[model samples]
Target chain A: MSGPATHVRGKKTLARSILGFVDKGLVNAVLVIVAIFWLVPTLGLFLSSLRTVGDSASSGWWTVFTTPAQLTIENYASLLSNPTITGSFWNTILIAVPTTVFVVIFGALAGYAFAWLKFPGRDWLLIVVIVLLAVPLQVALIPLARMFGTLGIFGSIFGVILFHVAFGLPFAIFLLRNFFTQIPAELLEAARIDGASDWRIFVQVILPLGGPAIASLAIFQFLWTWNDMLVALIFTNSGSQPLTVAIQSQLRQFGSNIDVLSAGAFLSMIVPLIVFFAFQRFFVQALLAGSQK
Target chain B: MTQLVAPVANSPAGGDKRRPPHGSSRRRMFMIALGFLAPALVFLGALVLYPIVYTVVRSFFSAGGGEFVGWDNYVTMFTNDSTFTAIRNNVLWVLVAPAACTILGLIFAVLLEKIKWATAFKLIIFMPMAISMLAAGVIFRGMFQENPNLGVVNAALVTVNSAFGQDAAYPGAAGRDGLGLVQDRGVIASESTVESGSEQNFPLVGIRVDSVPAAAAQAEPAVNARAGQLVGTVWLDVVRGGGGTSGQIDDGKTGLPGILVDAVAADGTIAASATTDAAGRYVIDGLAEGAYRVALPAANFDEGYQGVSWLSSTFITGVIILSYIWIWAGFSMVMISSGLSAIDRSLQEAARMDGANEWNVFTRITAPLLSPVLIVVFVTLIINVLKIFDLVYVIPPGSAKPAANVIAVEMWTVSFGGGNNQGLGSALAILLLILVLPSMIINIRRFREERQQ
Candidate 1:
């Protein structure tokens, strides 16, 4: 056989061998493992949340099967009913919603600026921001708290909201900017030639087409703000602790009542998961889309 | 979101000033830009910027408030005190964890995602990812427990040990439980009035585990005490020369020294501790049946720091960088793979027909086409790493043995860990937000640019 034919045949054989291996069911087995990896903790968290305090600590949640009827809803009932938890849950919602909304709105705008706007110090500002991204969160906490004290906003919902907004803006901007930047210049140019105002153009042309990007950005910001413990712990007072702080504060010095924590942990994750799966289709593609650029 | 509308501002401002019937439109555009941006900028400036300025000022002043010390705290931190140690340990963490995690993450993302069990692999790695830093610390602390660390890491080690047919050398005979033992016995006799007597009365004591059958019978497991591994037990004993209290050693094998006061309080606490023997040996066993930490005193510590938190603002920064690389690499790979897939098949066929080699076509055509996505990925990752707190915080913060501390974790620790000084903690926090703000703006701007494109 000629060299090209030989090489082509070799390549085809390799491909065929790979396909044959997949056809033999290795791929399916792997998928099951993947499903288990993702599902187990979720299942563990779910099962653990429902289990008795003793069961959760002494053994894995899988052992719940020994007495199939042993599953209890008491944890959930208690979680919802617990006065502290109830307040915190509501507080989390309050903190999370506004923080997420603002961050996304701000992020989208900043992203657009980086992508399309010609302004003084754009490159320098970009460099500065890149450098800023590396600053540790620890360095900022104390000063921010002091600032809050001066503003009389410390230990309140406002303080926490402000903190989340500040922190969340960067990531949202980072991801959204990449997504917005990739929109073909021709599209915006077309709108410009048509005399579409920038705001009109953004709202009409960019925002609509940027749906997938926005969805992902919103989801991330939502999860981040909702799950954030440090800012909430510092910025809010007794009346308005978010779930993470509330749950963490409940930690008894030696060992806490693991059951409540189990319940609380799972509950906290609920929104993110729901939000994630709710937008799972958008996420699957966009997870790497903006990230690549 | 106003930033999202920035481009709209561009058209009516200097960029498109000559547009017909645009006198009111220009005013409307400026109003829109201000309207869109005003709220966020207000919130950010009030919450983030002002605080950072306070920290920069605070860092130079004394706690009691005096004159501008001009980087005195910075100087003191670098020149003296345990803060230096914290910096060192943090540096090591920055160097090690992030780079490793990111590289591992990238590899895992690429390989594991392709596996039939891709989700499972993702879940396993991401399992740690999802857990809060405090929770992960608790879990890891358990996993890396000090005596027989009963966590997963130690269990694996024990399994490995069993496979090799090894055991702790001897029972607790390595040291007296709480009693003191002399370390050296000089040449001169106790009653000697010789010129060298002052240096001669050094106490020398040794445990005869072999001679004491019972002592050897209850020997604990001796195991590795590698840095940050977290589980193992050790003990040490000291016998006094003249019925005098020298120093009571606890852990008998090889481990760092921490006080284990033998004098039990009236409450009758066991106060079981493991202090290393003269050879710096301590063996801690029965560690709740899992992984544990065993450490030896450092001969000399080399300084490394993980940088201050929010963004990894240090020369020794590591974890953040690694994670950024990992996520970005994976992201780029995904995009590139897609881009590769999207390449016009007809073009490749055309190239083949023209007798161009595959490598030549790929270099000339594929790479250039892939550039946009790659740039987006790298820049976004740099920004993402700046904003990230989750992965770094999960590690915990400490500088002695590379405290798994991240800036975010530090913020949580200070704000909640109940310190005597809230002012300092707040200062640190304000600094964190300030540091992140500029980047936040950069990211948003990048987003706007992207959107406009």
Candidate 2:
């Protein structure tokens, strides 16, 4: 009886292992297919950009695999040499950098206040920030556009950056506050006992410990400001338009210039892709902080 | 737990009202908090709060803000056809795009659990999220072009059709005026009947020179009609670069190759059919001796599956929504995958131990546990889609812009997109705010719940 039971157990284990293997195989297949589906369109765009305009227009992008000699970098050369594309690329940096810097600074300060500082209506103020997170930026565009006109900042890069900073603070503060509140009370108390003021403790203790959160906030704010379009569209005119608006303007109704668009698109995508991959972990951490208890 | 510790640390000086130091400490903390919050508050007030208030006020006034119209703009928003179309399209987007992204995201997240190279997969999928909507718009617009030579999608479609031995039709061909053919919609048909042994001449015009197939031969009128057979010539009547007689197949005219011609009996049945060759000549042999209408069927002028007119009014919204889904599905995947990782594995393992299948375990144990994250992601997408402007503004062609308009784009158009009517735009803005408020409330509540947990 014991021998038969052992044999049966071995058989069961073998079947289960086979099932597990099949499960893994199935999962990998789906993942691979989905990954390919997501990557192919961008790959097609990139490949088409690498080919001459006539070659790209005459054949499907997949044909490039068979005919490698058709590939050329002329599109990229022309796009980079063009003054408007390069100028807008710099304009994007100008807008993104200032917006990111100010958002992080202001967000950190406000986050520190909400987390550690004891003040009248602190909870109410924090709630306000949380609620503001839901306020679509569209609601503010008209009034703000008009106000920018009055302040002589409409259609300027400064106006665009200021709008991004204002809109970015809510989520930035929310994330930082969550990070800051998790700090042990004993750390802040010890700093106070050492005669450090609130400002000193924030700068010395909280700021240093909140590296992940700050990194997360900076990455998020940077990506948002860099990829932003609607605000820039309504606020910035031709002189101050970012790469997004510039790319948009190149889109013609009939017989669109695919060569320029493909190259410009690839160029615009490169910086954010770098930022994303470099700080991917921080982005995931930010996602967890925002969603997790 | 931290909340419980916070007040105790602040009250270390004791609760005695008589202590001057304690009162001073509380006041000092308040002042410090205010100082820390000052810059963010100023910007938030000036940009977010004040603008919100001013938009509400502006919505009540006339276009130029000179008169107090008092809900007149709101009335126009509901009354105007374009604005109404915008509202309807926004509702469609809200109903479709977010749900699709979330579901796709959830599936990708769940499937990622079984793979070794999950990180790479996630990165590729999430790569689109990094691209600007403007770039995405451009990519999708180019991809969905109607011409096979210009658009990747149509090119693939044409390849597949040809591979399956299906001949493509000439969508651009039409009958020349006074060619004795009746034109209905786009299909052209011979009005008079022809005898079986008689020759027919189908002289068509309006086929663009570049659109002509490269294999097409020079047009020649058919001659030497055989008995009990019908012969015809379908050629481009217009001659390039010079004057040509109308409704006549003159020299230098190109053949309308590959057009399907049919001989229809009086009972509306096709008696015989033939396809034109390179020289625009076709012959239907063995036809019964009867008068038949030489017809060009609708398929001949069908525009021949130009791959969906993605930028056309009928499909512009769908294309925009598709682009939105592409960018956001990766975002949803990453968010939900993180949530999936946080889920307690023991619950799933226990369900499996009970002899449950993978689907059962997932639906019963895993999905239930992941609901909070799913709801958070879904609501976030809802708010995001409500404010979607760039894709709508950038993706659709000028002709389809009105058809694909979302509230955000409508707001811009009414005020800035050459409408220059700020009052109505402000009303549209407020309507958008009201539309987004419910999801925003749900998201905040979800955040509060997550914090509590």
Candidate 3:
């Protein structure tokens, strides 16, 4: 009876392994198809951007695979030479960099205080942070636009960056606070016993320990600010419009300027891709941590 | 603030041996914490909290902020056709877009587990989450262009359509003016009736010579009809070099084949029907002896199978939702994938050992385990979708914008997109906030529960 049972178990294991192998292959096949479906839009845009105006208008982007010589950088060259695209590109950097830096600095300080400091209403304040995280920018636009107009900074790059940093704080503080709370309290307590001030402890201990979270927060904020069109559109005029708004202006009602649209869009899309890939490890780590919130 | 600080200032003589004056130190800690938190608090309070309160208050005021007009703005928003359309579209967006993203995310996450190139697949899928919604709008706008030659989507549709043998014969062909054939409601018919055993001719001119089907042969005149039969020819009337006579099936013309011809009797009933052949000629044999009008129905000249009018007002909302799903599904996928990785593998192994198939394990075990993560993603998506503006704003054409309007875009348009009605826009914004509030509460509750755990 024991020998027969063993034989049956061996056959079951072999069959299960075979099933698993088949399942893996099937799943891989579906994944490949899905990946292709997912990549085709961006891929088409990339290929379209590299083609000449006539080629883009005359045929679909995929035809270039058969006739590779149709590919050219003329569109991109013309796009770069256009003052509007280049200026907006510069304006995006101008907006994203300051927003990122300010959010990280203020968020780290506030997040540390929320995590470690003994203060009244701290939990309530953290709850407010969570609530603020859920507050959509639409809620703030009307008043802020008025306020900025009153302050004489409406439609300025400075005004846009201020709003970006302001809105970025909630998630920044929330994510960093959660990460900082997980750090061992004893390390900070030890630093305090040795006469380290709260600022020193935060800079020396919490920042180093919360590096991945802070890095991810910065990336998230930068991307959010960079990709932001609603806020930019509402706030900035044509002169101060970021690449998104600038490119969007060229979108005709009935006809397409495919050459200009594709190149400008690709240029806007490439920066965040680079930033995201470069810090993908931290990005993923932050995603997992932030998901729990 | 001074009440708390006064104790520290007055307690210089109250130092204890071990704690170094607890009240003063605690006060210092509070002050330090306050100092640390002040900057973020100021921004949050000024930009987010204050603006929310101000928006609510301003919603009750007049457009120029001069008068307290009570709920007039809210009533106007509810009554206004555009704003009402915006609200309805927002509901549709919240219903469709998030659910699509969540479902697609689940499938992608689950499938990624069994694939060897999971990381690469994930990267490809998640790549869109990095690009701006404006850029995505441009991509999808380009993708869904009406012209098949330019848009990849329409081009693909045209390819599959032709591969399935569903090409239109002649989309825009028309009869020439002063010709014997008269067109009405896209159907062309002879001006006068012909008795059976008589011949008819249809001279079409609108279709470009080159645009005619490749299989079309040179124009042919109808053969003389036999007894009790009607014969006819339908061919491109214009000659290639533009010297052909009106109503004549001239040289260099080709047949418009596969066109349906009807022989309608005087009683408004069809006595016989025939389809044109490759040489544009048709024979209706065994017809009754009464006079019949040879007619071509509307189907042959239709703007046939012009790929889907995706950006039309009717389909604009759906197209915007699709683009939203395209950009956001990867976000949910990455989130759910993280949750899946955290799930214990032993339960799935146990289910497999018990002879449960992959589907059963997935449905009965894996999905149940991932419910928490799924709820988070779903609620997050709900909140996100409620505020969707960019894709909604940018993808649709000017004509279709009203159909695709969401609350966010409506608010923008009302305030900034030339409406200049800040009061109405504020009310719309407040409406959006109210819509998003429930999900935010659910999310906050979940966070509180997680914190307690």
Better of 1 and 3 by DockQ: 3
Worst lDDT 10-window in candidate 2 chain A: A1-10
Task: State the TM-score of candidate 2 restricted to chain B.
Answer: 0.74
TM-score of each: 0.60, 0.83, 0.89
Weakest lDDT window of 10 consecutive positions for candidate 1 chain B: B194-203
lDDT of 2 at A92: 97
Tens-digit lDDT track for model 3 on A45-110? 899999988887778899998999998999988999999999999999999999999999999999
Clashes of 1: 136
DockQ of candidate 3? 0.46
Question: Could you tell which candidate, 1 or 3, scores higher by lDDT?
Answer: 3
Worst-scoring 10-residue span by lDDT in model 2 chain B: B12-21
User: Candidate 3's residue-wise lDDT over B1-453, tens digit each?
Assistant: 121221222222111111333777778767888999999989999999999999999999998888999999999987899999998888888889899999999999987876668899888888888899989998998889888887878888877877786454576778877867788898899999998999988888778555577878887888889988999888888777778777767787778788889999898998889988888999998986789998998888776665887889989888889899988898899999989999998897777667676689889999999999999889889988999988987899888888888899889998998999899989999998898789878878988897667
DockQ of each: 0.19, 0.42, 0.46
How close to the true structure is residue A78 of candidate 1, measured as C-alpha lDDT? Answer: 81
Q: Mark the regions of model 1 whose C-alpha exceeds 4 Å error after superposition.
A: A1-7, A10-47, A56-71, A108-140, A170-206, A252-256, A284-292, B1-32, B64-66, B79-82, B112-453
lDDT of 1 by residue, B1-453 (tens): 121222333342222222333465545645655554455456555555565566666666664445566655545544543334444544554444444444444334434434555544443444333334434333332233222322233344555764674222332222232322221121111221212101111122343333222222222333544432222223323422233243332333222223111211223332223443333334333223222222221211111121123222342134334433333333444444555556565665566456565467556765576555545444444434433454444323233213434434444544455543344444444434554565456555654575465
lDDT of 2 at A190: 63
Give fnat for candidates 1, 2 and onward, in order. Answer: 0.19, 0.61, 0.64
